[model samples]
Target: MILIESEFPIDWVISPLPEEEGILGNIFFISRDYMQFIEGLVKKYKPDFVVEDKGMRSNEEILSDEDEFTAIFKRGGISYRMVDIPEYALNYISSPILNKKALIKKFSGEIEEYKRRGQVHYNDPHFQQLVMWYEYLKEDLKAQEEELRYKIRESWMMMGILELAKKQQKKELTAFFICDKRNFDGIVFLANELDITSEIINIKKVAKELEEKNSVEEVIKSSVLEIMPIKMKKKEKIDKILYFFDTDEYCSPFDTNMGYDAGFDVVIPYCKMTAERVAKLIQDAMFSRKVGAPTVFFVGGSDVEESERIAQEVLKSMVPPFEYPIIIDPRGAHTTASAIVAKTLEIAKKHGIKDLSNKKVVCLGGTGPVGEIAAIIASKLNANVFITSRREEYVKDLAKSLTIKAGKKAKKIEGVAANSDEDYYEIIKDADIIWSVGKAGIQMVSKEIMNKLPKNKIVVDINLVPPYGVEGIEPNFHDEEFYPGIYGIGALDIGRLKYKVESTLFNKASMTKGKTILDYNVAFEIATEVLFGEIIKISI
Candidate 1:
């Protein structure tokens, strides 16, 4: 008998069925060291069967203790089977010996090729040790015959293990296989061909001083490092991809620019997208990439309702474990509204107003998307919100819709027709804060109306065009005393916050692990954090 060294290095390989197949456990390929710690592995992996190779013997001592090994399995109630290729079958497949010189040269060339390709595992000490062993074993005819037998036996074992794995998978049970360390790479290659996701565990590297009597629990207790499976090679970093969908005839360049600024490596813009067309596009984008790839979907358009419909379609098309982040900001309305509300809260607190609760807020020309979101946010803060438009019926319907969107128990919002000076005065006279979000270049609140407002009231104008939304309030003003006792916040000030809020949301969506939705509400929370240095919840 040719006895091998007992202190040789060993490796373990674990393969698992895909989660979609409903197999909850892993198939482990363990080394000789595992025999001493079989019970430890059983408790950790909870495998149902243990398979041992009867042909591969490392040393005489282990073979002499075969009875003790079988007794350990029996005492532990572990179902085990010894497997091997029959002597006749092994002889039938044996080939005539080749030239040793040519064989050694071929192996050397393969090792050089692997190194040239920058294979990371080539540097592993255990792998280098295997190469040294192979070089030494090639010198003798007996060693050469053993090597050939080991190769043939490994092929047979792979098939046998795969067959056993399939049987266990049917019963939803896990199996453990013990094989020689020399067969680890071959088994891994076969597992890959079979489409099994395998994890490699180099026993010698993970537990360097593993003793013959050491239990798995003791080894685990001594090591502070987590015993994670080793990846064969480092995975290349996937590109951060962002899909920007617009309902208009042409996609907006603003959103795509911000997407790149937020650190996305690729931003794909889709124009003229509808809810019907978004489903297929979402499915295609999601399935083309590997799982856990950083991806985001941004929705923007002039039409708020159409953009919302497309966003819902995106949500519906995504499957679990593949879902990415989605940001809904129709024409920047969500972020702008959040900034406006957060700024209002900051100014109100500075002016001795505790919160927006029960305070009257008048939104001039508040029927558009930005104005609508602002009104909803104020309503959510328990404010008595009044939205003014030229058309009373349209504004009233919008108010009712926004109230429902806020929540079932939210405060009611009132709509008024501000077609004349009397109507404007009626709504603004009792307001604690006045927001002008009317058409650009149009002044919703004139100097004459501004002079008649109550003292110590806050006013905000979000129009950068000439003849700003609120007359006498410049675009750069921020909480400035525009009138004797009236404070004003300008469009540029709110625009800065809006830019910060939108960019922060994009950054967060790119870095988040699982599916995240960045809507008006999430924007509001982030805005509060950006402005107040922490999130401040304002409830009634």
Candidate 2:
């Protein structure tokens, strides 16, 4: 005989029974879908008699009218019976033999203990209620009640089956015992105790197996190839890996964390990397992977020139199909600069300044990596850009180099010295956009100088530390008027956009199927899209 088990409402163990002893609890109604499932099983097994848990009985006291389970058997001309513990025995077991209040308090303490031990699922509403009832029954009623309620009922059901088997003059009788999942183990143990042979069938597992078998059969029937007995080859697995190369002595935690968050399966970091060593690492990584497997390279460090060199080396080392996507954002300069320019342009357009073309733009302390990239981006937009530093000669030479990189033959960028407040005032007097991309904690423009600047100008500061690069602009201000007509964008506002730009680049590099070089140009494009919902392309 096969046995079927289902989940039980644990609360019923501690709840009061209905007034009529023969009438089962009203909480035991089966859905139409599950009734059909049980009917299918009954038809397949073709049992002479069907025995169900007492809770499945209808309230009708007459034998002519049947419950849902009894009706299923009656339609097939089969006999049916319901089994449960006797009313007198139930009343004797449920008597006040133990302290119920103390048991509840103990259960509450156990719940707190489970929470403290990090078993947090006990705090869920359904689980909490289930545990409350189950624990209460186990503690208050003791072992005798449990045996009477579960074991005795199951034994009576088995006796009924044996009596039917003998009446029908059959040597083997097949029965299906649909009991609660909580009492499944107890029921099986009792069957072994009485030496009754039975098989357990998990309905859900059997249904899943049948579904999979049907799917395979359908595929075989629709196949073009001739059916034959052969073992199918297993498909190989490929992992997406990112090779992160940092020029510094150690890899930066910020970049590695972003790489993992961007969905790379594995990230291998190499610190103190040089261009000479990058070729061998790339070759080793690419040669071992299958074709079409995602592999990416990331170049990062404080030294922008060294990072660029390493990136170029990585590209050179790869053969045609093995070449992978690479992201280059040294010291976050590329993305930061992109964010700065994109934000400036976004604010500029709002103020009726359609574009950066022919606008006078000044970059304070602009000889640094971030300032240098920002200066180039402004120049590429056809703006007349000026980069400043304390050292005049160094700033001028760097400006000349950046002018060539910006692809401007007319030399739209120039360098100036800003060693004093007068220098800052004179330089930014007619500027349409003033950016303070200086070293942290260094005040590039004092409040007096900011007040002296022209009205209707856009100002930005990238120094989060105080005294800030621009004296009056707060780090979190975005498009706020610090002075009468001067709109100021602060360091923290720019930083938020910079983070989005960098993350998008990393995710794209990880997902690309072919070779992609993510540099300042791509960073600027992504920044524009992220900030304004559309790409604003600069045609240089």
Best by TM-score: 2
The global C-alpha lDDT for each of the candidates, from Candidate 1 onward, is 0.75, 0.78
Candidate 2: lDDT of 186? 69
Can you write out model 2's per-residue Cα lDDT over 249-320, one digit (the tens) per residue? Answer: 999999898888887879899999999998888889999998779888999988887998998898889898
**Model 2 TM-score?**
0.59
> What lDDT, from 0 to 1, does candidate 2 have?
0.78
- The TM-scores, one per candidate, come to 0.58, 0.59
> Model 2 residue 108 lDDT?
73
Q: Which regions of candidate 1 are displaced past 4 Å?
A: 1-233, 537-540
List model 1 lDDT by residue over 328-402, tens digit each: 998899999899999999998899998899999998978888998899889888999999899989989988888
